[model samples]
Target chain A: ELKVEQNPLFLSMQEGKNYTIYCNYSTTSDRLYWYRQDPGKSLESLFVLLSNGAVKQEGRLMASLDTKARLSTLHITAAVHDLSATYFCAVEMGTASKLTFGTGTRLQVTL
Target chain B: DAGVTQSPTHLIKTRGQQVTLRCSPKSGHDTVSWYQQALGQGPQFIFQYYEEEERQRGNFPDRFSGHQFPNYSSELNVNALLLGDSALYLCASSLYGDYGYTFGSGTRLTVV
Candidate 1:
């Protein structure tokens, strides 16, 4: 069984600050993904990390994976209020398989 | 192109009743997967369908069932619903063997 864990389940940060969310899995999996969801809304895809040492960034958010360590990280640079939302990390053992999702990190960026 | 779409956005059902939800996959995708998301929690995989057959399933019980049409549309049926079953049901679609997915807004089922 693959268990995914995320740190800082709740976050409150000032705008323009930097932070990072960590995702660790209990099993081996090369494919990892990041998703963001607003209150009462569907999830929005953020990044797909396919291999070890893979890193992807969009705007102020950056995500990276380390298959060897079975860990992934989502980094936020200069956070803004619009970036506030619950973020999740999912890991898959195969290309075509179900994903095990993390507990989720709720972020609140205030002015 | 249009994204994945789910019908009956919100539903309220009594315990022990049965409920069905529907989903339409995105264009050019042939696989559909269903997930259950509770309040303040990440989505949990329920099952996946491909070639009109169930390809994978999670830890859900038999009371949870599904079907996929040739057109790749899907339906999720739950029997003997319990209040614990109440949650947002999300449908995700992707090409066969691909990792990228397009997710529907989801159907919020409330079991009273």
Candidate 2:
């Protein structure tokens, strides 16, 4: 079975601080996805990393994938209260259309 | 354009009852996938549908069944509901063989 694990399941940070969330998978996968979910809301796509060493950045968030290490990272820069949410990483194996998601990291940014 | 859309934002059902949930994929998407997300956990894949047929399924039991229409919309039906079945049912849409997908808000199903 493919297992995806995330580090720092819960994070409480002050505004302007920086943090990185890690996602490690047990098996090989073709793609990795980063998503953010607010309480009582559905997931919103953050980044899609398609290859080893692929990195994508949007505003205050950046994501990187290391397929050889079977790992991915979501780095938050200059965090703000609005950036507080539960972040998840998903792995897609081979040609399968389904995704296996990580346990998620709940981030709280206090002013 | 709208992303994926699911009906009955929330539902409440009792044990042994059956329930059906609906989904409409994003425009131009031909594949629909269903997932179950328990409280405080990530979503778990239940199945995927393409070309009006099941393309992939997860470790779920036969009680979990689904259908895809010609229009690419889909429905998920669960029989003999159990307390453990309570979770948020999410629907995702993508083009066939595509690497990315768009997800719906999900239906929050509560089992009593």
Candidate 3:
């Protein structure tokens, strides 16, 4: 079975600080996705990283995939309260893209 | 456009009972996948349906089943529910061969 793990399951950051959430997987698929979910809400797609060295950015968030290392990272820049939420990284199993997700990192940005 | 939508936003059922959750795929989507999200956990893939056929399934038991209609909508049925089965059930939709998925808000099931 494929296992995905994320570090620092809980994070508390002050405004203007940057942090990175790392997702390490046990397999070799290059397809990865990042999603954000607020408490009691559904997941919102953040980025779809499809290949090694693939990087995507939107506003204060950026994501990258390093398939060769079986790793992916979600980087938060200049943290703000509005950006606080749980972030998940999912890796596609095989070419079919059936995602196996990590435990997630709950981020709380405060002033 | 309106995204993927799931019905019965919340439900409560007694153990040993059965429950059905419905999902309508996003406009122009041709595949539907169901996932189970326990409290504070990432969504786990349950199954995927395409062309009215079940194409893939996860490690779940047979008691968890699903069906897809010609319209690409889907239903997830859980029988003989256990307390562990109570969670947020999410339905994700996408085009065939498309890696990106649109997820629904999910149905919260509580077993009493």
If scored against the real structure, what TM-score would every candidate get? 0.99, 0.98, 0.98
Q: For candidate 1, what is the DockQ?
A: 0.86
- What i-RMS does every model get? 0.8, 1.1, 1.2
Q: Sort the predicted structures by TM-score, highest score first.
A: 1, 2, 3
Q: What do the candidate models score in CA lDDT, each in turn?
A: 0.94, 0.95, 0.92
Query: What digit string (tens of lDDT, one per residue) describes model 1 on residues A54-100?
Result: 99999999999988888899999999999999999998888778888
Best candidate according to DockQ: 1
lDDT of 3 by residue, A1-111 (tens): 899999889999999999999999997876898999999889999998888899999999999888889989889999989999999999886554578999999999999
Across B1-112, the per-residue lDDT of candidate 1 in tens digits comes to 9899999999999999999999999999999999999998889999999999999999999999999999999999999999999999999999988888888999999999
- In model 1 chain A, where is the ten-residue run with the lowest total lDDT? A91-100
Q: Evaluate every candidate with DockQ and list the scores.
A: 0.86, 0.78, 0.75
Chain B TM-score of every predicted model: 0.98, 0.99, 0.98
Candidate 3: clashing pairs of residues: none
